[model samples]
Target chain A: MSQTMPDWSVLAATCPSRTSLARIANKWTAMAVSVLGGGRTRFGDLKARLDGISGKVLTETLRDLERDGLVTRHVFAEVPPRVEYELTELGFTLHEPLLALCRWAEEHIAEVLVNRESYDAR
Target chain B: MSQTMPDWSVLAATCPSRTSLARIANKWTAMAVSVLGGGRTRFGDLKARLDGISGKVLTETLRDLERDGLVTRHVFAEVPPRVEYELTELGFTLHEPLLALCRWAEEHIAEVLVNRESYDAR
Candidate 1:
């Protein structure tokens, strides 16, 4: 695909931006980005922090983030090899918005729960 | 469940906030809220603006948003009975972040596509 358009819009159904939005809008992606914002973390450590994430799911999320140029994985040469994952410069730009979203969820859960109960009652 | 802790963390495995995040972090929910930010829109109109959304998915997304108290549904007493959807006060608060995420996707898509191509080649 050659680049002709100077702008992309998510509202456009066929726009590739929708695919990007789909990836980043995922709950696991949000949490992973939020956690990785702290600093570089090993795969196991990342999974542990995310809580309830299956190893496979966490690996896929990280791989997707890596493929998107958002996260980088590093391997250290040693008798016992170690791996670490960190946000790239581009990923850092994403960190703020995603973290803001996580904060929003946490801050508003009380009201959302109340609403769910009432809505379910009706 | 009784309320005790003041803080709700999505990082916690079983926190209700995760459920809330899971709901709002959905791509369809994000798109729906972004479009609804314009003002009240009929169901068909909302589906149209969202682009590529099926009627069933759009209906379910709106219902979820309504149940979460982030959206309000109004039914007009008319010959045919018209219905429209609008963001509630709480939903308005969600608008900024979700829209930001969508904008990020649009703005960063070129870079992401490039990254995907390069990653896939490896």
Candidate 2:
């Protein structure tokens, strides 16, 4: 029998969904997902594409995504081992909303900058 | 005369838009925007509705949103005083995406939790 799911609201401090919102709303996570949306990527490639991300933070972010089932990691054995990360099916569902936020930031940065300058002048 | 806008990509290390993304993608900012989406709200009401947010953090979050032009703060001169916040047109545009993310988190928390448990078990 199907059970009724608990109503979840991120606004509620005690809701478990708050944790999920925190994870997905993260800056690094947003950037990482944006990059990964291109296709499967290697660790170094992801690090490079993400600009200023540190190797440690990238590792942590990917591990967290993996734990959350939003990303999958693959390790290949070779003369030198290789690893790749790709978004899972569930992650693909999240890509659009996440990418839209990134695009919004890019599109509105000019307006936001002007607002910041004016606010600081006051 | 109109000028061509420079390409702004969040994936770029030096892009200004990354700062905007960081602000909007913030946990408190997400929750604050979600609450303010209901319409104008008083400071006390906002604090109460957002659950465990500290007064200082809410103040800072509101100030940041105000600076970014995503929210407006109003002060009324009266008996004691009245202060309220409401989203600007730009903020209203952002509300849909931010709320979608929050709803996504709420909708997916169960799957994420199950993934965490199984991943931790392995």
Best-fitting candidate, scored by TM-score:
2
lDDT tens readout by residue for model 2, A1-122? 99888989898899999999999998889888888898999999999999999999999999999999999999999757889999999898888889998999999999999999999999
DockQ of 1: 0.83
Error of 2 at A113 (Å): 0.5
What lDDT score is found at residue A14 in candidate 2?
Answer: 94
> Which CAPRI quality tier does the interface of model 2 achieve?
high
Per lDDT, the best of the predicted structures is 2
- Taken over the whole model, the C-alpha lDDT of each candidate is 0.92, 0.93
Count clashes in each candidate, considering only residues at least 3 apart in sequence or on different chains. Answer: 0, 0
> How do the residues B1-122 of candidate 1 rate in per-residue lDDT, one tens digit apiece?
89686778999999999999999888998899998898999987888888898999988999999999999999999978899999999999989899998999999999999999999999
lDDT of 2: 0.93
- Ten-residue stretch with the least lDDT total in model 1 chain A: A3-12
TM-scores of chain B alone in all candidate structures, in the order given: 0.92, 0.94
Deviation in Å, model 2, residue A24 alpha carbon: 0.3
